[model samples]
Target: MTHTPQKPIGSGFGPASTADEVIRGISLTGKTVVVTGGASGIGIETVRAFRSAGARVIVPARDTAKAKAALATMPDVIVEVMDLPEPTAIDRFASRVLSLTDKLDVLVNNAGVMAEPLTRDARGYEMQFAANHLGHFQLTCRLWPALVRAEGARVVALSSYGHRRAGIDFRDPHFERREYDRWVAYGRAKTANALFAVALDSIGRQWNVRAFAVHPGGIATPLACHMLPSEIEASQIFDAEGKPVIDPENNKKTPEQGAATSVWCATSPQLAGMGGVYCADCDIAIALPSDGSAEMHGVRPHAIDPISAGRLWQLSEQLTDATLD
Candidate 1:
């Protein structure tokens, strides 16, 4: 939280590491996990990986029909209707989940919107902030009892390199007075995600409920819906012939690979006593500066700042009307 870097531990895994590989020989038997956005992309792979290791997973989706259809074959995975940005539905969903389980081993706040056009929830809050940060914040707070009951629960927030795009503004967070830039909004939301984890860990570590933030790396997915074709081309994620290339030097990952960090954070014995850290490639990452170069990678100071994290926790509670404290 103070920008003290966490050295990489040589996890025997790297960006290309798959979820199965990360969890190989490990058992999640009898563990209970909830993964938002588990119906598709890396979330789907995350659900699959955890289930393969014998964990029971609950997937909350905005579209229950699509979720059910996508997850229909997985008898062990439960698909529930949950649109994160909506406060009332989130509350109802939390109530239902509590009624079903007394404890939770893992919570993956992985659902998020990328660079969409300006949009707000029913509360007139910005969509990315509300959904990516506040929704998970409220859900985690509401589920506090079960998390504590687990005695060693872990919460994973899906942050990103987008965090480097912008830190929390404190004021004008919703773009009410300022003009909106989708990337900046998204980056701030992601920064909030990481900060949320840092703050949660500081509060919950005493109860054995730790938190972590993960950068899943750049993967081609439907999450790219908002990216313009020219922007994508300029980014060089795809070659001129439309073939996908990961720029091996930069370490782009497959969905399974992207999911490895979340699973690792959730179940790795190596990380037993560590919490409130940002992770990537199945290991805790070092905090790096904003060089404004595409080749650079690491958590930013603001994203993991303790002061901002604490303030955000307070703000999140105020916004969502939910908190364990």
Candidate 2:
């Protein structure tokens, strides 16, 4: 097939696509998968889709008890304690993964905190950037060997359309010298997620490992924990009655719909050799202006630029005291 990474390859699924629908006929009986935040909302849905397809899914959550309870009935699933913002925790988890398995077929970096009040991690990094980007960065690096061992591993990073707000602010990433805005911080972190995939695929493709960034649509889930009612109202995602409306024109997505892209990217045969692209609605996104308009549906240049991706990877290496091989 011809390779046009910027354009959708006519994936049969669309806005209304569900995880089960997209994954139909695909069987993963022996594959090992790991999903961060695989307990609730679309994360749970994604876990279910993969497990139903016969994949062994290992979910690492900060609240192990909560994850266990939420995922109690799911088969072929395991929940472990892992706080992404804590580098120590990520290191320990990655070590444990190595001790248990020699290879990882798929890794979904799905756990993330959205717009929230200003908070910092132990290293003084802003919470959103620390947990969403740096933590995944460090974890991917630590797990690079196992991914390589798989020979065809797929790593999916959950980005967002909010990436249009800003790219990485290399100097003040932690809100040290500048004022903080929740949306701007969240945007930067999401952009980092997309760029990380670009750089990772550029580097890892030689080993037959592909990476993708996923923009799960605007779903009303726990991801909105930090946004106030007024903020959500301003976003206009809900009806006057305060119930979610599944309007494609408005970017609304049910949790199962939200999970379609992640699972699709992880296992679809059509994307066998493609990577480093932003995906939404189960298709590769085109480039668009960063004008904050919903009509600008494709990715922005800044989010997929090789130079930007490479620079962020180097900076992430410095911040986490980790290196990319």
Candidate 3:
């Protein structure tokens, strides 16, 4: 299939559509979904909407207490401790999740660290890349059985506009020999997120398992904790009104709006047969320009290229020692 721009098909959804609005009539009774970083921000909103739609949502969190406190009022939501930075912890967490359920309808790889300083995980990989990409990579691989069992399982990888910074540095993903730049590291990780969907959809479609990469748009959330105040100020994300300017030109979106596309990709009947596509503003993205600037609509070709996807997949396997079993 050629990579063409996918229009809305008159789904009647827009950038302002809320998570609840996306699932207005979709009943998810008996559906099982696992959302990483579901304790706060857009993830929490996603959980609330899914649970409201009758799905049993499980949150794999690094801190169960924080997650439980945040989700105290929600029903059918369970919080389990699972640290993504620790590879061994991820293995155990996946095992526990498999033991609890035989089918997984959705897997939202929502948790991620932004442009943090140079640091390494327990496995000595870059912190941002490891936590955001490698962790989810292993989790999905380990849970492949359940996903296949569910039939038509959708895996949503939360990519970002930050992918414009750089594509995956396959030569040295760990940055062992190169100088570390936080934004570039984040860019690489987000790009990996998109390519992951492409590669996964290529392999998973036979089982009716589709994958999507989402640019959640720009949102003002705790995800900015790692950035300096000067950086935030220079970005001009805030206005004189002390609110984020919602100029589509800059691609800023509220958390509710940011979470909308993900929910749409997860439940929209419009995308029943589509997979391996990048989505933004509740619609399929077109091919992005090559300047690596965030001044356009659509995914970058390099980010979704099948060749790059395969290479990144192999690199991820080596870094995390995970196989799609």
Candidate 4:
């Protein structure tokens, strides 16, 4: 598969564009969407945008009660139970979804964990990588038939600018040999998210099921619960006076603005033939050089490399024992 160039195609929407704005005129009356983290943070905004556009939305959450409460105000939004870190739970959830729908129009892999202490799932996989990438990988594979049925389906993986921190440590991804650093682990997982999109898109495009990875900017979401106040401030997401900065140009964003790119990647007609690229601020992101001198914007070569994406896909299939075919 030829790679899609990483340069932006001048999508009219900018960083400040909110999810509602990007989806304003589009109609999804017969569409069905699954947003993994659709109960909180920018996930809520993502669900709202799709729901507003008349799509059927399903939100899978680990905590059913909390998810229901968070989304109670939104009528007809289905909330299901699925824990990303557990393989069995993911399979069961996918089965449930498949039983309900023959065609899935969109899937947003938005749920993720940020920097946390070194921990492993039952499979001994690192927590961040397990929940953020492998789990989504399994879910997408399990839902493969439905996605292909849609014929023009789109999958959006929520990656991060933090991917700049590290690439996949294929040898020590679980931190078995190397010492664990929470931030590096987070970066590795985020990189996996991007690569998953590349690989998935490469294969899925044949069935008109394209995939995209999105950096939803920095927002004051519950995703930061693992970080300290000082850490948040140090990350520049918060001001010295303890306020969340809302600078879109600098990647700081509100929940609605942060979800813009994900919504765009999923529903924008401008991206009909495009996939396998990293997106941010409602446009395909520019690819950064491998030299590592560029600022914390755009995608690194490793995250979008077709070879790495294929390698990661194989590794993920082995780790999760899941396959699309």
Best by lDDT: 4
In order, the Cα lDDT scores of the candidates are: 0.87, 0.90, 0.86, 0.93
Distance (Å) between predicted and true CA of 219, model 4?
0.5
Off by over 4 Å in 4: none
Candidate 3 root-mean-square deviation in Å: 1.9
Candidate 4 lands at a TM-score of: 0.98
Candidate 2 structure quality by residue, lDDT tens digits, 1-325 = 2223777889978878999999999998888899998998899999999999999899999988889999989845888789999999999999888787899999999999999899999899999999999999999998889899998999999999999988888888888998999999999999999999999999888898899999999998888989988988988778899898787545788999999999999999999889889999888987775545465478888898889899999999999998755
What local lDDT score does residue 67 receive in model 1, on the 0 to 100 scale?
Answer: 89
lDDT of prediction 1: 0.87
Cα TM-score of candidate 3 = 0.95
Number of the predicted model whose TM-score against the real structure is largest? 4
CA lDDT, candidate 2, residue 236: 77
Candidate structures ordered by TM-score, highest first:
4, 2, 1, 3
State each candidate's clash count.
Answer: 0, 0, 1, 0
**What stretches of model 2 exceed 4 Å from their correct place?**
1-4, 289-294
Candidate 2 minimal-lDDT segment of 10 residues = 287-296
Candidates ranked, most accurate by lDDT first: 4, 2, 1, 3
Model 1 regions lying over 4 Å from their true place: 1-5, 247-249, 289-295
lDDT of 3 at 264: 87
> What's the true lDDT of residue 280 in model 3?
84
